[model samples]
Target: MAEFVEVAKTSEIPAGGAKVVEVNGKKIAIFHVDGEFYAIDDTCSHEDASLAAGTVDGTEVMCPLHGARFDLKTGKNLSLPAVFPVQSYALKIENGVIYIQV
Candidate 1:
């Protein structure tokens, strides 16, 4: 069974924006792109930085610390310095509220 926790409302994050939320003591970054929502581990795999603070270009997020890029849809490390993909969480939106499966 999966447990879903409400993280934020749709209005909290605008299109092409992101926010960091803590669920079950784990930090997760939620991104809004083209009216869709995606969630992933907030920490950068290459360094100790917040992915939520990184620059988002389409579905790719560049790590602020090392310029490593990651695919928001698949959590794939799309650049150097970050060989490991960050953990991507399941997300759902219901009635304007965003839920994350932890």
Candidate 2:
């Protein structure tokens, strides 16, 4: 089983927002949507843009570099320029702290 690493607290990211965190030296994006938390690879599949800096609309985030949209729940590439989906990670919350397994 993959070990879950505590990355940040729930208050660190607002609802419908995301934060960038390093897990094992890999950049990961932690998102807070509605009342749920999700995680995914921070790098865009088509370009080197940081998804954590992208804009979030519901469960989808738009790549700031090329406007490529990706589904946070599944890391599916939902627009052009990105032919492959980014990686998605497992997440959990305990005592208001967010943990990720990449």
Candidate 3:
């Protein structure tokens, strides 16, 4: 089983926003959408853009570099230019802390 590590506090990510956190030297993007939290790899599959710096719209995040869109909830590439989907990590919430299983 993968280990769950506390990545950030719930308050750290504002609603309808995303945050980039380093876990075990790996960059992970955490998003807060519609009162739910989703975790995914920070790097854009199409380029070197950081998804955490991208715009968060509902459950989808747009790549800031080439405008590739990804579904934060399922790690699905929803637009062109990104043929591969970014990796997504399991997430759990405990008391107000967000934990990610990597």
Candidate 4:
């Protein structure tokens, strides 16, 4: 069974901010938006770019490289140049800490 790994604290990521963490040796991007948290693969599916550095709009992120957009909730590619979807992780919060299932 997959286990949930502690990634970050709620305070570590402010609203409309993002952080990159390695869980089970894979880089995952954690986002805090509108008082909620979301997690997805840190790498962009379109290019060799970091999604953590992308722009967050609502619940989606626009890739900084080629402008590929991805839905933070489902990791679905929302724009062009990205033919595949990045992996989305299950995230849960307890107290003030964030956990990502891996």
Candidate 5:
């Protein structure tokens, strides 16, 4: 089973925003959407764009480089220019702390 690692505090991510955290040498993107948290790989499938620097709207995250849209909740690629789906990690919030299963 994957172990949960404390990535960041709940207050670190603003509303409709995302933050990148390195856990076990892996880059993970933590997103805050509508008061909920979602974790996914920071690297974009297409090119080398950072999803953490992209725009966050609800559960969707758009790539800042080529406007590739991805669903943060399911790691699904919604638009073109990005054929491969980004990896997604499990997220848990406890006592105002954000934990990710890595």
Candidate 6:
């Protein structure tokens, strides 16, 4: 069983914003939407673009390099140029801080 690791504080990510943190050498993207938090692999499935830098609309994130859309909650590829889905990480919040199961 993997233990959850501290990533960032809730205040570090504003609503409709995201930030990337490395865990076990893997980059994980943490998103804040509508007072909720989500975690996913930072790299876009379509390419090497960073999803944390991509634009977010609702629960979806559009890859900045190739314009591919991915679901932030499930890491599902939702549009063209991407046939694969990225990995989604389990997240927990305690005392305004974010932790991820990596």
lDDT of 2 at 76: 96
Tell me each candidate's TM-score. Answer: 0.96, 0.95, 0.95, 0.97, 0.95, 0.97
The list of candidate 2 runs beyond 4 A from truth reads none
RMSD of 3: 0.9
Error of 6 at 22 (Å): 0.3
Which residue pairs show backbone clashes in model 5?
Answer: none
Candidates' lDDT values, in order?
A: 0.94, 0.93, 0.92, 0.94, 0.90, 0.94
lDDT of 6 at 40: 95
Worst 10 residues of 5 by lDDT: 54-63
CA lDDT, candidate 2, residue 62: 96
Please give me the total number of clashing residue pairs in predicted model 1.
Answer: 0
Candidate 4: where are CA atoms >4 Å away?
Answer: none
- Total clashes, candidate 2? 0
How many clashes in each candidate?
A: 0, 0, 0, 0, 0, 0
Q: What stretches of model 1 exceed 4 Å from their correct place?
A: none
Query: Cα miss at 51, model 4 (Å)?
Result: 0.6
Please report how far candidate 4 places residue 8 from its true position, in Å: 0.7
Candidate 1 similarity to native, TM-score = 0.96
lDDT of 5 by residue, 1-102 (tens): 789988899999998888999987878899988888999889999999899999877789999999999999888999989999988988888999999988
- For 4-58, candidate 4 gives per-residue lDDT tens digits of 9899999999899999999778899999999989999999998789999999999
| Model number with the top TM-score | 4
Q: For model 6, what is the C-alpha lDDT against the true structure?
A: 0.94
Model 4 CA RMSD to the hidden true structure, in angstroms: 0.6
Clashing pairs in 1: none
Query: What digit string (tens of lDDT, one per residue) describes model 2 on residues 14-100?
Result: 987889999888999998999999899999999799999999998999999999999999999999989999999888899999998
Candidate 3, which ten residues in sequence have the lowest lDDT sum? 52-61
